[model samples]
Target: MTTQQSASLGLQAETKRSSVNTAPEAPPYCGGDTPARRPEFFTTVSSLLKDADGVTVAVLRIDSPPVNSLGSQVRVALGRELDAALSDDKVKAIVLTGTGRFFSGGADVREFNTSKTKVEPLLRTLIARLEQSEKPVVAALNGTTLGGGLELALGCHDRVASPEAVLGLPEVKLGVLPGAGGTQRLPRIVGVAAALDIIVSGDSMSAEKALRYGLVSEIVQGDLVDGACRAAAGMAKGVVQYRRLSHKPLGADAASGQLFDDARKMAARKYRGGIAPMHCIACIEKALSCDLDEGLAFEAEKFQELVNGDQSKALRHVFFAERQAAKIEGVSREETPRIDKVGVVGAGTMGGGIAMSFANAGVPVVLLDSTDEALQRGLGIIRRNYEATLKKGRLTQAQLEQRLALITPSLDYRDLSGVDMVVEAAFEDMGVKKSIFTTLDAVCGPQAILATNTSRLDINEIAAVTKRPGRVLGTHFFSPANVMRLLEVVKGDATEAAVMAGIFQLAKRLGKIPVQVGVCDGFVGNRMISHYTREAYFLLEEGATPAQVDGALRRFGMAMGPLQMQDMAGLDISWAARKRQAATRPAHLRYSRVADRICESGRYGQKTGAGFYRYEPGSREPIPDPEIEALIRECAEEAGIRQRPISDEEIVQRAIYALVNEGARIVEDGMAQRASDIDVVYVHGYGFPAFRGGPMFYADTQGLDKVLATIRGFHAEHGELWEPAPLLVRLAEQGGRFSE
Candidate 1:
């Protein structure tokens, strides 16, 4: 029989079966009566039933909770249901959907490297079966459809989605291109340029955009499953054609070499040193040039290659590490308290940023300063920041006003009495922090959690000033707090478990990654960064120029070179800390006076337009300075040290390994709960590249034995500064990994 004839007969049989199975007294199979043939196998990962249309449109709902990830069980269940629907004389069409907020979150990331991923009827194989189905399939996208989930939808003969649904192919974010037919089929529907943007950028597209791109046939007004079933019924009745995406021809632009070339260039610029974007472009090019089967095979080949590569491993490690950072050993999320209002003390850059962080999250904030001038200045700066976002079209005028209104500036300490929490972003002085806490204890309610935004001050001592020490902890928000994602929750000795839990929950509400660290000087990120910067300064003292040292690190995927970053952050800040520690400094230990001398000259970095590098007026770009080069030589000569040529290899090892060594010490000292937590801090707070999986994970990738050997060599040549941590020594001896 012809395809149309078969579909017509199937429809007739479906109507008969629906009438016979669904009783007249019952509303429908969904409401009262059970379907006549409810398969036991479908109860686990999916459910099968007839739609309200009284036609046998087999509604196969993915029942996996949370995100309907297509794990082995889910894939197997879905395949069996598809087979059952196809064989059933009563079922004329199929409607695939999912329960909860996600149509599917794609493949199970938990099964990425495991044996289950290679099981028979893999996602690719199941999608092939779906594409070749004789009966039409309609995808009912209820919510988020991403990665392999989007790929599955493309295999369907037709697609309809709820207005709230979002779709994307975001495999490149996990360091792999789309392995299924996403690279090939997406281009067939959305054209080559649009597909390249979607897949390479790994950003989600809204249902409206999906409709505009022809990715979804229609946006359902009411019930998504009902609309999808109606669409399926139309195809079964031959009113709508069962159009296969595999048979669709590539657009005319697909043949343009320049198109692919431009995409490759854009990918390189946007995703520097990333291999996945380049590979994604290659797969899309294959779709343009090769047949569907060949393109799919090539995509799978590339996917397997990337998934097994070191970059993908590191990326995946980071993906899990971020989630792992949220958990505390003794604290449950139930202990967390609601924080409706927050008070930020101090009206400088850090203080203003902290207030903006709360205001952006829809939390009311009281921004307190010592004087009216300072308070207005801080509020003006916040307004300017929001105005800049508005200019970029990221914020509407009403949103900008709403955020600004959330921050109420004040000079009186009494304004903080009713706040749920108070974060004192004051100067980095124990005396000053103590004074603020002492006042806060008297002025604020007993239940209010008091926090200090100190980078390195002893939090235990700060807690000593307050009567309710259990309510005191440290909330170290990174600079430009609203922009940076890290919030190091410092758990002081007397800090209550509930306080820690509360801060962690609040950090998430503010869109920050909170890593719980025990109280210590500089905590994890700053303590490790102290060693990193020390090595960078030492490299300069040893004959590496500012450009050479920074260049080497930049080549290693650092966001900015050490000297340039110092320049941007201002050199005066570290100069004060060094000066404070000078009296207690051990004379025999090496110290770089380069930064101090720069500060003495009043060239405190970009603020002064001259430090390690010179800058033009109104520009932040660092220019190589001959004056600073001469100063480095003078400092070296004064210390009676001879400068020697340094290799870029040595530069990277000293800088990165310094972070690794100190991170190990922090973990051992109990300042950091685990090595991966240190990685989270650096990756989120310190601009450490996520692709390298942060410092500790990078050390693991280099092998503990290899890292120990490098450190031992440095120790022999450079004295105590390069001494390997005991944990590193023990791990190296045991052939263990820091990541574990």
Candidate 2:
């Protein structure tokens, strides 16, 4: 049970040789440690030419622009070139490499669902050809080699990589196992434990680590192509002996069995909601037990199954959704403004977090507060945060000091005059925010961008007080700003295009996913979550408990349950907001009083040791309380609501559909550019499960008609609280999806 596939492909017979070479022989082109430049030559995605020596050694370069992704055309071309090189009598050996920064980034993701992916000369066919070629093929990993790219290299007889090259198979992140021999060949080269670690984590390793793991033959410091060519020539001359990865024996024993068992446990815990890691582990186990041909077929079958599954579809939707969020209307063509220095007003919780974000990006920041004591307290929190990071081994002492040194805490407004951008993370009062903006407008430079960190306040009123309305917008960083990855860039009515472009670019620099949203009561995420949380309360009032509601959503892949999230976020925060809006709340609109009652008892949240649930003195774990359930029962009785036994399915449908219905209204209102942008805000900002995509994608998957039918039923039962959005009804009638 060796490899029937390899023999059918006409690979040379396997020869016994020592895998470990005590004194590894260098290639003929090996020079001094100095970085040497590769010989210049023009080449396309697939072209064969000779190295500096002569045409005796054929050199094939994959030169597709932006990372040589293996599309249909590239694969077909490489197949043809490989056949030609193998047929040429003068060509002794072939060296394969990439032209630019990446050797190959894997498959063209854009072609995943298209017919091109299934066309002739597929990646599998090309890699098999490389494995069976008469002439020895040396893979020159020029830079980053990932997914199918690494599989291609594994097919070659030998591999040489540039020192800066990074290699891995990250298909697991996208909810699919690597389809192109990655699972089978990788374990054969780097043992089972390392293979599981690399594949399960879906992380890239450095070239040095690749060499150490015997994944590559050598770490070529300079001129990757030249080194590969020399290595190929050595193999042709019998100076170097390399074995095919497929023919290697899988030393499966008790230890290997333990490794697979451990991998299963890890995948079940870390990636509970996804099926990709489990599939990856299963493929590796099959590879070890079966022959190469059977294992390959098994891998291909599993790959097809996972790729067509809902989880992969949802994950892929998220992949494209993030890219779609980057294109802001009327801002893509504008010249981005330079922001070298940042100023943060109100050195409280959010202000300190925002300041730390800028400082972490190596930008100098001025943190301003009204009193010296306030500034000192804010600075102390930043120090403790950095110290925690250092203790976790995430940051060095130098890095902590450098980041801390970038933030200058002060009480004076004059210190912000020299900063390029000023963000006000003050209290969420219109008057208080307007006063700060007015002062910033008068004191700060005209070119500086004025931003507010208000999560729900109107940016227009805050900008109206300042003469430079065009320079004002909202940068709604989520709670604990420095740790969160979402930055909702709220566009004001008078916001300039350049200002939007600059902030978008700046968000990327700070390692955040920036989604452009129009100014409104809660913008995209919070506005939609309002409906979601409302439904959760309604469920509670009916028959469900906090633990029941949270458990249902958590099983559905949410990072946290709505009630648990409310408890952790402090129920009083939203209670105060509700009190402010109560004056304007419509008379007919249904409102739940359970949360208000909890707040009335002075139970804030984890901060106050009780809210939706009680917490221990030092622990933040939510402990279900019978007293809270009694209170909910009383509220329901007073509201004349009949309690019914609610299934988990009903709970999930009510909560998720609420988000979809509200998201539709937001899209119809043009607050968000597209449905995908709304999805991005939720996935990155609101802890919506990435595997389920976002509410919009989930709606599409469930079918708009089905969603509408459920909503219509809810509307009939719950009245205005569950009213189907006009957009949802329209799309359902038209048979259109949100993605379209």
Q: Which candidate number has the best TM-score?
A: 1
For candidate 2, the 10 contiguous residues with the lowest summed lDDT are 24-33
Q: What RMSD, rounded to one decimal, does every model reach?
A: 6.6, 8.4
Candidate 2 residue-wise lDDT, 104-206, digit = tens: 8888776777787888888888888988877789999988898888999999988988878999998998889989988888888787778888898899999
Off by over 4 Å in 2: 1-48, 51-55, 246-249, 329-334
TM-score of each candidate structure, all chains considered together: 0.93, 0.91
lDDT scores of the candidates, listed in order = 0.84, 0.84
Model 2 residue pairs with clashes: none
Candidate 1 all-Cα RMSD? 6.6
For residues 1-740, write the lDDT of model 1, one tens digit per residue.
Answer: 22233223322222212211111121111111122343333332454566434567887877654566777777777877777788988788888998878888888776788897887789988888888988889999999898888999999998888889989988887889888889998888788888988999999999999998889888876667767777787788888787777554464556688878888898777766779999999998887667788888898899999999888888888777877787655765567777999999998999999999999999999999999999899889999999999999989999999999899989999999999999999888889899999999999999999999988888999999899999999999999988999999999999988888888889888999899998776888887888899999888888999999999998888888988988888898887777777898889988998888889999999998888899999999899999999999999999887999999999999999999998899989999888998888987887787778889899998999999999999999989988899999999999999887
Q: How accurate is candidate 1 locally (lDDT)?
A: 0.84
Q: What is the lDDT of candidate 2?
A: 0.84
